[model samples]
Target: MKIAICCRKGSFSDYWLTYCEENGISYKKVDAYQSDIMKQIEDCDAFMWHFSHLDYKDKVFAKQLLYSIEASGKPVFPNFKTVWHFDDKLGQKYLFESIKAPLVTSYAFYTKQEALLWANKASFPKVFKLRGGAGSTNVKLVDTRKEAVSLISRAFSRGFSAYDPLASLKDRWRDYRSGKCPFFVLLKSFFRLFIVSSAIKLLPLEKGYVYFQDFIPNNDTDTRIVVIGDKIIGERRGVRNGDFRASGSHILLPDASKVDMRCVQLAYNVSQKLGLQIGVFDFVHDKDNPLLVEVSYGTDPDYTECEGYWNEKLQFTSAPINLPKMIIESFIQNSSN
Candidate 1:
């Protein structure tokens, strides 16, 4: 059997190529962007691509291509359910609720008047977020009815750009202070502040609709649990000073004990039910109740401090696990069976 991989210079593809080569797995590197991508993949049984959220061209059609390939009967890593909500929190709001998952109370409005009306009656300190973004980059805290109203006006007016240079600078500073990044990283972030808009802005303003979540107070950290097949790796990201968002706290560890078992149970159950090959779920809690924040298909494992992993049966092991290899092998095994 042969497989085709959508090759990029860096990213998971690097590990994929190395694994396939070492295992004597027959594979070809194919570009999923070209006009003849369909014909190009005709010779392979599966395709894999670590499509990114920061690429303009990729944002435009990566999922479309992946879906098309799946529709054509070839397997893909992010087959529909796994990816349809990749960068879209709005879509996820509906999905989580539909699945009866314990998502933080959230509201979405498609009109300014509706948003304003809700703002009048809604409580303060709601967490405002754009539909797409990671690391708490676009997440904001709306502390009062007035603040919510003002945001509603702006959201419906020229709309808000998905990219915030000033926020980027603050994040860089936070990482530096936390010793997670260096001085040069701050310099790069400063330079990027003036260079140009991020590819995320190609998304346009998130006007016409506003989304807010009930802020869970005193949440100093958020738990991140990643599940691939039966292996699970999890982390806890501490929030920045006085901030409620934890996804980009510049801290991570793989100590499962630090994570609430309830959250892990929710992530594992939901991901398994969805038939997701992989899922990285964010969560925070109130007292002992863990609440889900968001879910994604990817996370940077390089810096994570996972001491071990858990299996589908909830058994823990101290052995170092290989996610990229697991991803590729699953495709092969699923096909043969």
Candidate 2:
């Protein structure tokens, strides 16, 4: 079958193209941004595009485009089931609850009055997050009622920007101090303080709602398990120094021994129930039970590297594998059926 792939330089498309070339798979490169994208891929049996939440253009129409294409009965790597809640935490909250999945206790309120009422009654140290944002970008710990009220006010008033330049700079500086990044990278982040990103500028402010997750305490690290088709890979990410957020801390423990297979099995079962082709689930413990913190369909390809992967039966297989190749093969198999 002929396949159409939208190539983004550093995205999964690069590996996908390499796999196509090596395997002699019939494929055509098409740009998803083009107005005639559908016509371009009309002859192909499947389409694949690695759209990013941080991209201005993709945020506008990627999901709509993918939904339309899939509705037409042609296959896509990330279909509607896989990505309807891709970058939306609010959507995921409702979805997890509906499915009775082991999600952390969360609350969302659209009205200022409702949010204020809840804040007044809720316990301290709730985790506040903007519906959108990855890598702990818009996440904050609300330790007092006053802080929660202030956040509610901002959510109903001027609103929060999708990008926080000051926070970004601080994170970059921390990384540089820890020798995780170079000085040049830190310098660039400093300059970015004055100049806002075009993507963030084009996006409207996040307002009109507040989301909070009940803080589960005493966890120094969180587990990230990624399920691609039948394979599961996992790692533990340590929280930043003096911080509770671990998603972007970059302090990773790649030892498979540290990964809890129970989390892997939970992710696998949830993915199956959701009919997802790809899922990356982050888990924080509620005492002994693994409660899901968040879910996403995309992650950095570099982070997928592990000593091995687990099968559906929770059996570990020590082998080097290409994730992008696995994704394409799964798509092909699905399309053929």
Candidate 3:
């Protein structure tokens, strides 16, 4: 059977194409943004698109398009359940609660009055977040009720932008200092202060609702577990220098022995229950207990650096991980069935 893939450069589609060509799998490249995207995939047995939340166009209709394709009884890489909550933290709050997962305590309020009332009584040092954004964008630590109230007021007023130039610059500087990126990359970030992209300009302001999660303190690093079918790969990311967040901190501590199996198991269990084709879970620790910060269906596809991967039984094997291959293999197998 043939497969339809939306081939964006540097996306998971890159690996998918490589794997397909190397293994002699029949596939065609189609632009999901086109008006006749559905018709283009009509002959394919399955469709795959690594839609980005940061892109205004993808944000507008990726989920709807994927959901529509899956509804037609054809297997897609990320079906309805996997993608509906892809980048939505508000939806994730309810989803984790409904499934009784070990999600960090989260709160979402639709009204300024309700948010203010809760902020007044809620403890300090809560983590404020917008509904969207990856790599720690739109995330903040509200250390006091006043700070929470200010954020709440702003959320209901002009709202928060999908892009923050200052914060982006700060992050780029950190990466530069840590040698994770080149000077040119850092320079580009500095230039961003004056020139915002048209995509960011097209994005609607995030407003009317404010979300917060109880801050889990004393954790210097966080773990990310990514499950592709029954195979799991993970890594530990150190928090930014003198900062509380870790997701975007390019600090990679590549020690498979340090990988927490509990977090791995939790990621697998949740993914299996939801029938997700792929799942990426970020976790922080509260003492000995691992608490989930958030989850997504799409993340960086490269897992070659991971020393090994764990099986569904939590058995670790020292082998390189190829997440894109696993995803395509699983997709083809299921579609064939």
- TM-score of decoy 2: 0.98
lDDT value, residue 284 of candidate 2: 97
Candidate 1: worst-modelled 10 consecutive residues by lDDT: 298-307
Q: Which candidate, 1 or 3, would have the higher lDDT against the true structure? A: 3
Give the alpha carbon lDDT tens digit for every residue of 179-292 in model 2. 887899899899988887676799878999999999999899999998988888888989877788898888988799999888999999999999999999999999999999
Model 3 worst lDDT window (10 residues): 297-306
Task: Candidate 2: list runs displaced more than 4 Å.
Answer: none
For model 1, residues 54-161, the per-residue Cα lDDT tens digits are: 677888899999999999999886788889999899999999999999999999999888888898888788999989888787899888898888888988888877
lDDT of 1: 0.82
TM-score pick, better of 1 and 2: 2
Better of 1 and 3 by TM-score: 3
TM-score of each: 0.95, 0.98, 0.98
Query: lDDT scores for all predictions?
Result: 0.82, 0.90, 0.90
How does residue 23 of candidate 1 score in lDDT? Answer: 89
State model 2's lDDT: 0.90
lDDT-based ranking:
3, 2, 1
